[model samples]
Target: MATTPPVIQAKITSDPVKLPLAPLLVSVVVGVVVATAGVGGMICYLLRSGKVPIRVAGVAPVVPTAPLKTHMVALEPLLVNLADPSGSAFLRAGITLSIEDPAEDKGKETNAGEAKPSSKDADAALRDTALTVLGQQTSDQLLAANGKERLKAELKSALAEHNPTVKVADLFFTEFLVQR
Candidate 1:
């Protein structure tokens, strides 16, 4: 008959067990994904709250427009020196002012009736305004790409200031010649 051997006690360790590399990596990835999702949700909530006035897609603002009754008043040719110090460059421009239709203002239906202001007064005012603007511009300014359009805008403003009641709809350059 064989005798049974006595069992020995196993020793316990104080150090923690090492975790598997795969599971640790998976936990880190999950934590990052959860944090990113939380941040994105917060941003969406703030945007929807309308505390900020973010413009929505496919929405356009309204603009007011004036009635379209236009008439042109031709001004005589203007010759003026440019802003250049040596007076080497000059501008000769023939401008036409698009004024409000007199027929519309008077509520009359006439074919060839002249506008209210005398031709002499209107011509002088328009010519003076145009000459002042053209004379102030340098050769470089006149030759620039958007120079003509800028000058037209400035002239329109000046015309408005000169005659408040006169609605100058647009400015047309019948002849624009710049000599340098």
Candidate 2:
């Protein structure tokens, strides 16, 4: 006798399962509102805490700067004959002096107001010192690549001999002409 095969059972539904649209939309809207509120709160906190730099109308920010050490002053041009063996070379140079700020000086003051000479007095004193220094330089010395720097250092040293309070910062030759 042949055995009959076991019958298979099957269940079928006509309607499809669907997710509720209202709940999904409500959740999305709640998430967006929460995110927006969080961003707005952060912005408000930053503004209130003064962490953000805000420039107001006609208001400038106070920035810290290093104290100025040196200042520049223009000096009258000097015409001097160079100390050459042939004595034919001469130099005409317009020198600008970079002087140290006396206000920033920490040295002890002895004479105070009376001892501190005016810039005009200092310049007048510097004129003779400059002429002496230039007159001592040879044509080759003034014409070299490092001539100007050497001259500046020499002049600073010479000027210091005359006036210790008048510190020389630098020297610039605006017009340099050598005549032989």
Candidate 3:
């Protein structure tokens, strides 16, 4: 005789089943998001705590300068000889200069209380300049029609050097004499 196979039974339960891992997984994800948000907040707070300073440049100064002082005096006369290839000639020289000081010129002190000159400063200065220039003068230079003018320039420069305190601005000729 063949024995019959045992019968299997199927049953359905009405009670709810608990999923243990689902809540733990959700908590871990939320924790990670919270930690990231906390770190971002900390970084923002640190940045806001630091200080940044600003700087600027560009400034100008304001001031004025004083003008120079000058004076002029008439020259006596200058006689120069020409150094020409053909022959010798004569030149008359005259000039005026803008001296820094009028006192350098020879004259009576206009001030009523001023004393007379103890030393011949003016005469000496003039003579010195004249001789220096006359010694170096040439016939060609003196023979020209404008010889007086050229002499005046040299005289002015020389006189000015002699009278450093006095500036020789210009030269003039009141009397001229030239003989060939």
Q: Best candidate per lDDT, number?
A: 2
- Candidate 2 lDDT trough over 10 residues, lowest sum: 108-117
Question: Model 3 segments beyond 4 Å from truth?
Answer: 1-98, 102-119
Against the correct fold, how does model 1 do in TM-score? 0.58
The TM-score values for the models, in the order shown, are 0.58, 0.53, 0.40
Choose 1 or 2, whichever is better by lDDT: 2
Which of candidates 1 and 3 is the stronger one according to TM-score?
1
Give the lDDT of residue 50 in candidate 2: 95
- Give the Å error, residue 11, model 3: 99
lDDT of 3 by residue, 1-180 (tens): 899998887688888997799899999999999999999988777767664333445755656763333444455676666454444666565545444434444342356454333236775687667767765766656667887678777877777777675455555566666556
Question: How much lDDT does each candidate structure score?
Answer: 0.82, 0.83, 0.63
Q: Positional deviation of 109 in candidate 3, in angstroms? A: 15
Clashes of 2: 0
Q: What lDDT tens digits, residue by residue, belong to model 1 across residues 1-180?
A: 898898888898899988799999999999999999999988888889976578779978878875667777888888889998778999888888788765446565546676545467767777777788888999888789999998888888988898776779888999989898
Question: What is the alpha-carbon lDDT for the whole of candidate 1?
Answer: 0.82
Rank all candidate structures by their TM-score, best first, as comma-separated numbers: 1, 2, 3
